[model samples]
Target chain A: MGALNREQKDMEEQSAKHKVVHYPQKKNKVKRNESLKSNAIAWAFLFPFMLLYVWFMLYPIIQGFFTSLTTGSFGMAREFSGLDNYVRLLSDQAFWQSLWNTVYFVLISTPTIVIFGLILALIVNAKLKGTTFLRSAFFMPYMLSISVMASIWVFILQPYTGFLNAILGQLGVSEEIFWLGNEHLAWISILVATLWWTLGFNMVLFLAGLQDISEEMYEAADIDGASAWAKFWHITLPSLKGVVTLVVILQSVASFKLFGQPWLMTGGGPGDATRPLVQYIYELGFIQWDPGYASAVSYVLFGVMAIFAAIQYKLLVKKEG
Target chain B: MSKKLNIKTVVYVFLILVTLVSALPFYMMIINATRDTKDILMGFTFLPGSALLENYRTMMEYVNIWNGFKNSLIVSVLVTVLSGYFSALTAFGFAVYNFKGKQPLFIFMLLMMMVPGQLGLIGFYELNRFIGTLDTFIPLIVPAIASPFVVFFLRQYLASTLHPSLLEAARIDGAGELKIFHTVALPIMMPAVATMSIFTFIGSWNNYIVPLVVLFSPEKFTVPVLMGFLKGSQVAQNLGSMYIGIAISVVPIMVAFLFFSKYIISSISAGSIKG
Candidate 1:
């Protein structure tokens, strides 16, 4: 019998056995009836989330893949030119440049966040006076939205009236530096904003990791006459290996979605020097009205991020092995 | 002993200095909001200036930020309440029920969490358009009701905390199924739910790109979107107004952060470990 028919038959048998076999029968029959009720109850509760998830997330993902294979802009009749969008993406310079810019950002910002986060965690995680206030201070910036972060940085990095240059002016520097206008400096501005805005979460992760380390280890190191750096290098580093790896992977994933800050701060300006791939996708789809090509570019980003998660999972498995 | 003291001193001093660096811009934002355009452009001033009311006036004059604030408040609250309640209900289902296909279905949720929010951008935008809900708050608020991360988080919480015996007791007392969830499971799940609510509210409030993509009308815009327009829409040199607008936009979240910061921090840390 087919699976559905078999389940129906089994369920009917259980119900009939419960009815006819009476109170003296095995208790398993009654248990099966209760479990069947729970099954219906579960679906009743889960149905809303499942409905929306299917409608919004799953349907869109499937649609996005289908949309990627088509050749059309918005409002145009979609022509199923199989893999043409992908083939066209292969030679697109804008695609390559945005990809490179995003990768470059991921490369630069991930380390800055990781290294600085570790140091910040170590400092604030110390049993020092007023570190509570210091912890709040370090994390306060992360609470601001992207627009607020971008605006603050812009106000601080503007050529003449910027706070950074004003401070520099008092310190015997006379020239106003256009921090957001230059090609290299714009990336610097983005990295600074990103680092300021996000490093707090990384620090918290490290702090959690640090807190998980046992006090006994510190005493053990002390008895062995280990130095501070020596203890950190030996005990702390090895224990935090998992957290460090998790943080690194998490940071890279966050960095890869580099749309809001760069888009707001630079407008992908000074000749698209700071346009990340996500921004490129937005402009291509929304501005140019090319959803097919945009979905194609998106899949490229999707594939790479999937690989990032896959690599982390592989590392975890290898560690377990 | 002196060497260790020196290292400790260095660490404290360095941390203090860097902490100042972290807070300086937010300080500048708040402080600069009080200064006039010329005073702001003249130089950075640590002291409060006299343009606070004027700047606030100018911000309201052009941006209609109050309207945006109302819209944002509506969207964020609806999204939070809906996502929080629905996510918990779903978690309770998975935690209690042992239906066929449960494992595969849950693995699907885990996979959903792994996929970044932006991956389905094209399809989502198009789907909204296809459904004729383009430019509506429904597009923004409704999808959030099915937040996979929230589901995953709450499920973990429920597994550890929820007891089957409590539900069995509720059933024995003849409480309805939904009533058991509404009263029993929900009350037990309040601490975790409250922590997740703050995050969900903040996420919805601070959301920029989704609203930016979908929203077209000025009145429908969220605060973040308006923050951008307040700067970009400076058909003239009204930079001071923009700063004040941004300062206004930031204060609510900052205050919210200060109020429930410990819970927020614990949630993020727990979220990472769970992920």
Candidate 2:
């Protein structure tokens, strides 16, 4: 992207200096010297950021990988046990449970959030009254922090005094259900909370994609006496294909990092039923003080996300090409 | 025409239903904030109650949520400022300068952006421990300077909108490179900077896990961490106070979001497409 920009910039500069073409050799020397000079200057500007980036971003990655191969906690001397952490993780029950939980969340929540977002976007994008209100209403929950969202959900989902139960009681339900105490119910609650909290973001993305689809296409479709379903099926769906792919990939990547909601809502339980891979890494690295094993699990997560990222990058590049 | 009108009516009804579902929790939160624990326990009510001061007093007795607010504000403001200025600087460098290894460096940053943030959590914790920066805001604040996604967005914004001829004109008029960046480019990029800054501030404000892991002190805890603390503490027993505490964290941002909803929504839209 940067190289393309620079090439275009060079072309612009050359065209702008069209009348001064007689000094080509001198210009080339000056340009070479200027390139070297600009390199230093650019580095100067980039230096402050690079310093912090390397320390925090780059170093931690390398350090995390190194720590994974060792056997110790932070602030202590370590012994190198080559690939032992990885080998152990291969058969680790808790690790597998957490991995499955995270993937399950990605599987369930990603599609729901993306599809619902598309529906919301379409609803708001309709030629109707009160869309501004509709848009804000849909997106407002997204503005709150995860903790707040979890608190509200927990308040509603808790057994006896919970809001949902109260509503159910008015409708003559007898038994008081423990929403977060049962394993399956707890996952459902987390999924519901996750969807409500994040669906707005995907909605906005789809709205953008919807707006980009030209009116002329729809008008032409209408001229052909296409029904609303026919127009949506043939034009709207195809036009939104890119954004849907982008949202799906992004949502899945996000869902894979699930922690805060379940961590707060159920503390990853009814017996670790909702413990995401991230919460597992947190438990091992922080609570248990086993930095080596935690770092190993972190790498596994990085590996999983890298697959999604690679696909996203390939699609983005293809679109650009 | 009647059929079309019927479809529109159905669509409107569906939209209203979604709107109510979306806003239901918030309505309950507000109503519950004014109700005492006993009242909340009795059942949910739509009417306002008279325990607002009592709830505030109870919550304040347990936790200084205002302190958490202050800590969160300080950290988020600094993170936003550092991320915006430094990202713009880095983006300007990449956008304008024909530097050696620039392509590789930019690509490296892009790849790093794709790396899940949790990948570095353990090592970052260790690094902070090693450097004795754990329990300090340095771990949270300093990392904002190298925000790759912000830089990527800003560079893309600059690539299309910024003209090299403008920089050349500034140079001919005796402006230094840095001066031109500040005086010329920065102003042009302010809209984008402001757009990105909203996300940065919100991201920092809502960051939970990092602060939970790094900061141990109650007074230094950010809003999200404090919310967790509130859940675990005695405050959770008093449902009204707990609702009020959560509301205190949410309502201000909710109002701000409403005020800037159009801009914020547009920025999200633009961000996804550009991103």
Q: Which ranges of candidate 2 are over 4 A from the true structure? A: A1-30, A311-321
Q: Chain A in model 1: its TM-score?
A: 0.87
Per-residue accuracy of model 1 over A172-252 as CA lDDT, tens digit each:
898778899999999999999999898887898888788878999999999999988899999998877767877887788
- Supply candidate 2's per-residue lDDT for A213: 87
Model 2, residue pairs in steric clash: none
lDDT of 2 by residue, B87-204 (tens): 9998888777766787799888877876777899998888898899999999999987689989888887777777767877888899998999999999988988998998899889
Residue A266 in candidate 1, Cα distance off native in Å:
1.0
Give lDDT per model, in order: 0.82, 0.87
Worst 10 residues of 2 chain B by lDDT: B94-103
Model 1 - which docking category? medium
Could you say which candidate leads in DockQ?
2
